[model samples]
Target: MTGACRRARELVSDACARWHLPELVAPASVVLTELVGNVVRHAGTPMQVTLTLRRPYLQVAVTDGSRRDIRPVPAPDVRAEGGRGLLLVRELARRWGIAPLGDGKVVWALLPAA
Candidate 1:
């Protein structure tokens, strides 16, 4: 899982650099990690991560083989390591959402490119 997260971060960072949107690297990396990590830890199924340039936003999408709906919950315990991924996504992303995709779903975040 750690390796997958690291690779996702590197991919997002490299894409941001290539697109000349260096400012997006940090947020995009964070968002990707959180989204992908969620799939790894919870879904435990096949997943796909994608980064795309969409006008003024850089979009990150994680598609997983699960139909369960995901929602951001407030962490009841400050010391808990889990349950904070979506919260971080909400904070860092310009906007985020989950959409049903056949038998699974795609969780996505958009960060401002400008």
Candidate 2:
């Protein structure tokens, strides 16, 4: 999980640098890290990460082999849900959500690039 997080951060840094949206690296890294961490902790299955640039927004997505409910913990006191990873994602990200993809699911966050 540690290695996966590191790699995901590196990829995020690369994407931000490539897109010339250096200001987004930090928040994007946090969002991506949280998304990946969710996959490692909850999904526990093979995952694929994607970083996409859409004008004023940067979308970080992680597709994992889990269809189970994965919701963002926007509120810090949501103990009945899970950890605060998604909480951080909610704070750093402009918007985030989870969606079913094939037999698995894809968790994503949109960070402002502008």
Candidate 3:
């Protein structure tokens, strides 16, 4: 994993720990992993992951160098083990979206801080 991604996980876990929210730490890690992995896979080098916390909510934003269109597509079959990262993100995250950056975009996911 990239340093930015590893730091994101640590920051999120630390934030949850500070808030006395141990329950959310693991899921946050997993979701962060998937999103960050996507960035690493699709966007090449020079990526960043930012983490924000707001009492009951936590937002993770991953910035990468792909101005090209990228959208999360579900697997064609339910039993398919691959191409399910975004689906897992959708299921576990409270809300998620992509936002335009300087020349790329930021894929963000929000989760309950608790």
Candidate 4:
């Protein structure tokens, strides 16, 4: 989990730099970390992370080999450590959703681009 989260952060940071959108590095890192962490904890299967710049928004997608749907639940307790991944994504991303894939699903978040 630690390694995957670190790598996800690096990937988002690098992608922000490569795309010349340094302003998005922090939020992107947070969103990717939460998404990838969720995949690591729940999916327990091979997954892929994709970063794309789509004009007015930057899209972050994590595809995991699990057919189950992911719904962001409100944190039951504010002090709890768990169950806040999707909530963070929901708060940060302008728009986010999960799309069903043939064998699994792609959880995606879109952050507004300046």
- TM-scores for every candidate against the unseen true structure: 0.93, 0.89, 0.82, 0.94
Q: Which whole-number lDDT from 0 to 100 does residue 63 have in model 2?
A: 93
Choose 1 or 3, whichever is better by TM-score. Answer: 1
40-113, model 2: which lDDT tens digit per residue?
Answer: 88789999999999977898999999889965355566556657787788778888888897899888888887
Give per-residue CA lDDT, model 4, range 1-114, as digits (tens): 999999999999998988899999999999999999989999999999999999799999999999987765766687876787788899999999999999999999999888
Candidates 3 and 4, the one with greater TM-score: 4
lDDT score at residue 51, model 2, on the 0-100 scale:
94
lDDT of 1 by residue, 1-114 (tens): 999899999999899889998888888888999998999988999989999999888889999999988865576478885777898899999899999989899998989888
Best by lDDT: 4
TM-score of 4: 0.94
Instruction: Order the candidate numbers by TM-score, best to worst.
Output: 4, 1, 2, 3
User: lDDT per model, in order?
Assistant: 0.89, 0.86, 0.80, 0.91
Which scores greater on lDDT, model 2 or model 3? 2
Q: Tens digit of lDDT per residue, candidate 3, span 35-98?
A: 8878777777577777788767888778888896666565658676667778888888999888
- lDDT measured at residue 40 in model 4 versus the true structure, 0 to 100: 93
Q: Where does candidate 3 have its weakest 10-residue lDDT segment?
A: 68-77
**Which candidate leads the pack in TM-score?**
4
Error of 3 at 96 (Å): 0.3
Q: In what order do the candidates fall by lDDT, top score first?
A: 4, 1, 2, 3
The model with the greater lDDT, 1 or 4, is 4
